[model samples]
Target: MFSELQTEIEARYDIHFDDLSLLEEALTQANYINEHPNYHGRDYQRLEFLGDAIMQQSSAVYLFKRYPDWDEGRLTELRILMVQTRSFAALSRELHLDHYVQLGHGEEISGARNRDSLLEDLWEAFIGALYLDQGQDAVMNLLEQVFFSKIDTGFYDRFVDYKSKLQELLQKNGTVDINYQKISEEQIENNEQIFTVAVQLNGKQLAVGEGKSTKDAEKVAARRAYKDLTMDK
Candidate 1:
């Protein structure tokens, strides 16, 4: 299972794990320990937390240097999109990282090994393991090859929250009232939640959007609001 991933990483990212044990530990899911009493209890959760921060900081630094002309708000929006779970899941898929994940009998039978959230967490754990075993430079190189290399200026621009841009536009135009309200929320399949958000301006509904989270839905609604407002003007 891990051999395929090793080959994939070597061919695609040009990085090889020197210590196979580290790689194995990195890919070990929490469920893997539940089934085996002899396994002596080591999981990737701690590493995932550490990697999450590392990934955020690394992406922040990269974006800060790459988009010097972007304002703070725009940069923040871009960074949020970049570090989102969906983005990490996409990266995991691109690298076939799920193949290397180790799950116990129950999780494996339940297909949790291939879950986007689990895969994304494992990917972050893998990054944390790389940082510990090799160093920041090695992890950075791997990130550049596997993820950052594909990010273009246009991609960042597209991912930015248009609602923020609209806010600036509205402020410039002497209008300051903007708000978002959550209309509904539901738990969908695969442990995901859906939220509907209404965008309002001056106490009137502008537009609405449904997304995986209230914040995401509101952002989408804000984008639509921005479009509607701009077109009206």
Candidate 2:
């Protein structure tokens, strides 16, 4: 029944699921099951939960083994960069896993497939399903091939902690109030909203930026604020 999907997955990731239903479960959103009353399969939520823990464990192990010279604080930050929403979403996009996600008609029409949060969840769910169908070694091998390989090639450089950098810079000259304010939100196609956020220092706006979510917009604003403040010095 899932011959095509199985073929594509194996071709892309060099891995295969003995039980294709597990793959379907990973791709199935809650709304999809809600819309299909006769559907006996489960949604991705539980798998996502399990996958999240697996991802964290894999990241911690990788960091510990690879960066033996680094301390706990530095390793923790690097692991955060590895498993964050944006990173997972980006990885899902790179693998074209978003294309396989099964959504309800409403969610499909609403552009949930393109949402970063959904993509992140889908990635985790897929990982969870894979672990169940395969094993821990298979999960580790897949991550090494698809995810950690990218890290080795500097994929993580894009996830710089601009927010923390900006805060540290602003606090260098004694403590000052730092805030991120939403200036506006505009609805785009498919009901997706774009948020505009401004980074403020001492109640004064430093820079303004925009993104698909508030957190992303704040990151952009912080990056801009950091750059602007540093460029003057």
Candidate 3:
């Protein structure tokens, strides 16, 4: 199973793993260790931690060079958005990294293999493995290949802080007392939670949004409020 994946990664990413074991460790979730008593101590948690830092640094450098005009605050915000959990999870899905993850029998049966948090950690673990196998250059190359095309001037321009924008619009129109309330939450199928948020401006409900999380739902609600407030005039 891993042999074909190894070959595919090598061919596509131009990375040759010096130690296949490292790659194996990257794909092994903690749940896998619980299933095999002999492998109880083996887990990818540490690798995920190291990979997370490596990815953050690599993305910061990439953004620095790509957007020289951006100040530290702007760059930091962009970096945060780029390396966010949602972004990493999305990237994992694009690379089909979930297919290569190793899960325990119970986790596999429970479909934990496809969980976003697992996929995000797997992506970081793979980064750590690449860093150890080939060094920073190889890892940088892989990141560039996967993320460079997605970076553009528009990414900077369109990366507005919806919350800030909503607050600004509300304040300018004498509605500075806007509040975001979590109306409800539901665990949908596939272990995902759906949250609904209501955006209230000056004690009046402006808009509502539903999303996979309360934060996402609030952001969407803010976006809707922003649009409505801007257009109301």
lDDT of 1 by residue, 1-233 (tens): 66677787888777787776777777887677877777864688888988899999998998899989887886786688778776787777777777777788888899886687887798788888788878889888987876677676334434566778767876896867888889999988898899999977788888998889888898788777786776534
lDDT of 2 by residue, 1-233 (tens): 35576887689778898998888898889999999999999999999999999999998998899989888987897798889888899877876778888899999999998999999998998899999999999899889888888876657756888999999998998999999999999999999999999999989999998999999899989988887886644
Candidate 1 lDDT (Cα, 0 to 1): 0.79
lDDT of 3 by residue, 136-212 (tens): 99988888787666665334323457889788766774746878899999998999899999999778999998989
- Sort every candidate by lDDT, greatest first: 2, 3, 1
Lowest summed lDDT window (length 10), candidate 3: 151-160
The root-mean-square deviation over C-alpha atoms between each candidate and the true structure, in angstroms, is 8.2, 7.7, 7.7
Model 1 misplacement above 4 A: 153-233
| Local lDDT at 19 for model 2 | 90
TM-score per model over all chains: 0.66, 0.71, 0.69
- State the weakest 10-residue window (summed lDDT) of model 2: 1-10
Error of 1 at 145 (Å): 2.4
Clashes per candidate, residues 3 or more apart or on different chains:
0, 0, 0
Mind sharing the TM-score for model 2? 0.71
Error of 1 at 109 (Å): 2.8
Candidate 1 vs candidate 3, TM-score winner:
3
Residue 97 C-alpha lDDT in model 3: 78
